[model samples]
Target: MTGFAQLLDQLPLRFLLASAGCLAAGLGVWGATALLRRLPGVALQRSTWLLGQATVLACFLVILLPHSERLRLVPPIDVADMAPSRAAAPQGPTARPAVGGAPAAAVPGADPASWLTLVAQAWLLAYLLGFGHAVLRLLLARRMLDSLAATGSRLPCPGQPARAPVVIEVDAPISPMLFGLLKPRLLLPQHLRGFDAAQQQLIVEHELMHWRRRDLQWLSVGIVLQTLLWFNPFMRMLRSSLSWAQELGCDRDVLRSRSPAQRKAYAAALVAQLRLQHATPKTALAFGGVCASTLAARIALIREPSPAHPRRARVVRILAIAALACVFAASLAFQPALARRSAPTATQAPFSCTVMVDAASGEQLAREGHCDERVTPASTFNIPVALMGFDSGILKDARAPVLPFKTGYPSYNASWRADTDPSSWLQNSVLWYAQQVTTGLGAARFHEYVQRFDYGNRDVGGDPGKDNGTTQSWVGSSLRISPLEQVSFLRKVANRDLPLSAHAYDMTTRIMPKRTLANGWEVVGKTGTAPGLGRDGNDDATRQYGWYVGWAKKGQRTVVFARLVLDAKQESAMGGARAREAMLRQLTARLDVL
Candidate 1:
């Protein structure tokens, strides 16, 4: 897979898990609100909605936390490697006709890969459509409000400062409402012109309270979140609840200083405004635009308001905030556990293996998939090839003389077209240069060294007349090695256990690709590629196999790892560079070695 595809594979699952956690926390807070319903102070009751909002914010923070740290807590498992034994029978050949032909019937039902691809694409399309629709609706609402403002006339209200909200009188079928985010204006329908001074004061107080609390800004936040998570039902429910809480909180604040008789007058004004218009513009907050149930609740709250102790209310708010903090911490701490359960079964990415070992103790730290399954060494054999060339005095150093390119030889990559030196050969994976080195050493000496290194199946023999058996034997012939053996070989190289001169080892290290991490650690690695079908070296027609083997060092500690992917279609399969990227991603996530 491409690096971008691999990174995208991880996002959806993580987002879903975090969303689930946030929903659960919201429900828990909603349930707690029920017990607080009878509290005398509205501030204490409003704490529940605040807790819900804080919980959602915390969930997002947890989602953004570095996944590597969490993933490292769980050791890798070989779940894919164990799948063959669970199968009902051996599978038939996977090859199919290239042109128009009858499709093959699935063994059980639908094809899982195709189904997953369709589902992912459909979800993304739905999200984009929903978000676009929401944005358009918001724009429409804003236009309606702007149209009303343009036709109305602004008037000055008594006992208010010049910089206070500018009151606008409009001939529209709408209740008294406040519109605009900054420099807000209150829109008063002509129907409200006949109301008494006391009722007008109560209505103005209610709209101003909404402005003081910046309810419009918070409403915009809610709408944006609702648009982004349009597919999540829990988010919809939470947003509705938050809207109700905002209105109710504003109601309590508006009535805080009024007497019981004045509260009754405020309720009457609310009812009178409702009779004129039942609906409010989406971009504006209306004093009497709430539904029947909310209106009744507001009237009841105004009729029998209860006072609460300031100290007690303060304690309750603190406790609620503390509860939200705890939930946030717990979500982050348990993310690995949640991720483990949500992680796709190993069968999804089949035919891959990973092995990591501690360089100091020579102990296996982790293994996943078929780490012990043997495959061709591919271009990875170049490591030993280079070492043998240096030790035998065939090459003096890393900067040894360049090998002249042969025009008659078949070339696949343009980079291999020109003559190259030993360092460039290893860096660019120049196949021809490796073949020349192998041919110069001859099969006899090469076979002797392969046996001494205990490399793979240790079979160096191949077709006798085919380029002296150098290309076939090492690239795609009988020679084979497992990911486990690759790690062992790399460990030996890191420990200087091979029978090579110190200069040869140093020169080889100097030529290895090195990537430095932010933590000051260094990763040295090599990539290898082979044909999916053995005995076919570097043929583009066949599928491909890829390998990445390397060691990481920091201070006195070191780690050796090998990652491999096999038997995949050429276009979809990980190539040599992609294999190295995959290995680096896995290592950075699973270990502290970067």
Candidate 2:
């Protein structure tokens, strides 16, 4: 996937849209079902109604299934490498070069190259499955609609039928809407509209109120979603509840203009219409998705005094909200502590591979392996270089442009096959540019800078008295400070104890990538790349490590350290992917950043 697409996949918009649609459709279907079942002598059972409702939802969901694609990284794999050879083939007679060139000699022990084909194949399979499901659902919905259209008849009116009220007429005998908001369509039989004007007016007013509120539209949207994600029972309940609330709201509105006596009359009119119409309206809106008991309860509610909604319910709701908030806060507070508790004990912690000493106090907080590991110091060594450069007159200004240079010096790990400008080299992590800056600073000066700052292990090799230069071993030559030491150096840099000016420090820090953790903490850090670390010669599988030496802050700055290892063969892409995940999890557990 493209970088932009990958980024979008991580966002929550797709989930939000799907959830909202499902809720709306569910509520609408429930309201319509309730209204249909309330009608007298309606033969359809709630089970049948629910089945049809689900079918309708499934069909709508199929149409909207295209929006929910997510992107994820896949691990890298190796493939055999085949190279062509150029030497002339041995032959007694003169032989022309073979077609498509002769096969080249293979490297004795080299592994194959890495490819990302696995993820691509998986994505293809998922896409095909989703597409097939959507097509099948759409066809099923079309078939159901066709069958309904063939068997159902519209309510006949005096002249051309006027758009009276919006409803989802069901196979029920009810005249009043059962619910309000979600898909509040009106239901009627073949000749139900021929009822007396007064009776028709009352029914029309109720359903019209629902239509005006746009309940049906929201219901349709929700049903589509429910069909797609039917497994979530909680979502289903929410849909049903919302539909009930919608119907109640419509009833209140319809009754507002009518007197208590008029409402009673309206209820009576509904009964008369039910008796006159032999068959219930099946065009969605006839309301009444419930049984006789619910119908009796609604009628009773209408006949009895209109009881005001209790204030206790509101108080209970407030308390519920408060309780939820408290639970959320408690969870947030507990996660980090739980993480720490679950973490391995101090004795199980990795040995100090490198000792981290506070620059200001010269204090060591953690240690790793027994032997002092020597690393090439990678870009991290640049901090001291910049500092010493500022101290000496040679660098002169901290703002001096990194100049271009060319060289072909070979190094222990990477070959300086060709050279470029100093700035370009540093920008691209070119060994030659980095070495020149290191060399220009002089061995004594570089050693002094290392000692003055306590940036890392001070032994530069050779005698302790002598200002020895770098190590000879390729692995040993790499900048090898552990995560703890890296953070210690950064803490000092952030404190600005070194002679380097603020401009120099800020410039260096600004170059690092900005990563915002879930817990609202922000970190910035630089990355490093080295070759020959992996079995493959290609850079794709090369060994990679990074020092995310940065500060974490909610609103103010608090220094923090993060180190990452990269390998194309693991954690999908480069090692940064794994490192980022670990750091993000830690940050999230510690603070609710997002």
Candidate 3:
């Protein structure tokens, strides 16, 4: 169950919807074909088939057409206590006086420009998709005609007997042939003879099967839709689905007037044709043969009067319809921006290290750096650290102090410094303070918070060098984190659903230092300096790493960012501070005009 949920969460929205759409289309074609097969009488059945198809085509067009353009009204509230007097509601009373005897203005309806723009975009997309499919159908028909002509088969004159004017001309090689409207053509090479009387009848019957049901036209339409929506896997599935339906529909059509023996002979003829025309062109439809699996199905249908038994066929049809209906219902029932609220408009407040989440409708706002290459995060790691502290009781309040002294390896030769405080140390990104907090939280409590976040790391207070962390002077080893992970952690922090109390969270957020720009706006962030890893200075003596991350909320935009200077030496570990400033300069410049 957990794995299933994870898989669903990981799936892209496009893939999920496409899968459902494909299934719906396949089931639609299948159920329609099956229904056509069950009907009795060749002429009556074919008429019904054509009628039902035309009805479906009409319905599809209705869906494609633009809906009525109507203004959506905001429903009026029946505020009984605040309801205006009936006389005043519909008509203007004598001009009302303000405290100074001035008349106040009435509120006007908001501008509809944004809504209109969205509506136009939707209509444009629908129009493009619809016209694209139509163009593809024309192309498919043209190609089919060309493929048939290349095979050198001639179309028998219309209204002639099924096998009239049958000639085995020595001047022309015999080729395969298919008869159907919408570019109907034949396939015959430069050197083959006509089949005997019985074989010719069966072949002609099979081709007529396609014509009777207009299977070629449906195939062309389905092919066009598939081509237009090529990115959708469901569209790809529709091709095979409609292809199967067309063949099945034709098979049943052929069965309607033929004896069981005649059916088997026809199936045999199809197989023979497929073998004879081994070089079947992709552009042409060959009446005599097809895919091996399709051929096998036809043969099986010949042997069994009801290949899909009546009862089973009905069950399959019902199941397919029910599943398809469920998918369509579910898709249509959805409201927009369900995952997150619609993000604040460009005019709303902004976040630094900006996580553009829509708090109202859950729509994610578009932003920069979404396409930037990934980078390893350094001390921005502490955001999650602070989160763990808040979630668990250990390292409880932001205001509470835990000023401890140093006696570790890097400071072994130096006297113990006793003035270490959590608030100040955290603000300064002191490594020793972070380690002390981690130790105070205890292994069991620490693991609990780690599990909750599922940050993909499993180390429980292991040596930094041994795990994903690198060795640092003040803190023995520190864990590695990615910039993306840092932004994610900050989101949870800002959301205030983590372990800390509302007050503590507010205080910590408030006390965090902010770097003020030339303009009035200030940016809040934290900085980290640590020993570096891998190819470092001689014996790793001077290796260092630096990190800074925080959010900046400007009008309507809250940008959260993380910066890192990995594998540096000495004071260069503080390079992240300068990098953060540069990044902010570029970002703010873009936001200022907006």
Best by lDDT: 1
The local distance difference test score of model 1 is: 0.66
Q: Which ten residues in a row have the lowest lDDT in candidate 3?
A: 78-87
lDDT of 3 by residue, 383-474 (tens): 55665555455555665566656456223212224454546655665555566666667656665665565442222333312331222312
**Candidate 1: tens digits of C-alpha lDDT, residues 1-594:** 221222254344444444555666555555555445455553324445645565765665466433322222232211111111111121224433212222222233222233433454455566578778888988898888888888999877888766667899889978888878777889988788788898887788888887788887776667666666555555566566666777777777878877988888888888777777857755678888677776887788777765647787776667666666666665555443221111122212235667789987988787765454455777788889888888787777777868788887547878899888889988888888888877788867887888788786565654322433555776655466778788888898999998889987988888877898766668898899876642212243345668888898888988999887754555654467668888887767666732
Off by over 4 Å in 1: 10-22, 32-51, 57-66, 69-114, 158-163, 333-594
Per-candidate TM-score against the hidden true structure: 0.54, 0.35, 0.35
Clashes of 3: 41
Each model's C-alpha lDDT?
0.66, 0.43, 0.44
TM-score of 2: 0.35
lDDT of candidate 2 over 1-594, digit per residue (tens): 121232233222223333344444445444444454454311112222334345334433432343211110121111221111111122112333233322222233322121212333344355456656755765665455444444544544343225543334345344444232322224454344556676567676666666766666655555554445554454455445445545555566677756777778766765565455433222233434333445565566556535444464454344433433433333222211000010011111121122233334544433322212222345545555555554554443433545544444544334334444334344444455455565677666766666666654443432212222432211223124435556666777767766666766665555445678755667665544332232222232334543334555556445455443432335354333444555556555654422
Candidate 2 residue-wise lDDT at 36: 43
Task: Quote the lDDT for 219 in model 3.
Answer: 59
lDDT score for candidate 3 against the true structure? 0.44
Full-model lDDT, candidate 2: 0.43
Error of 2 at 222 (Å): 4.1
Candidate 3 C-alpha error for residue 78, in Å: 62
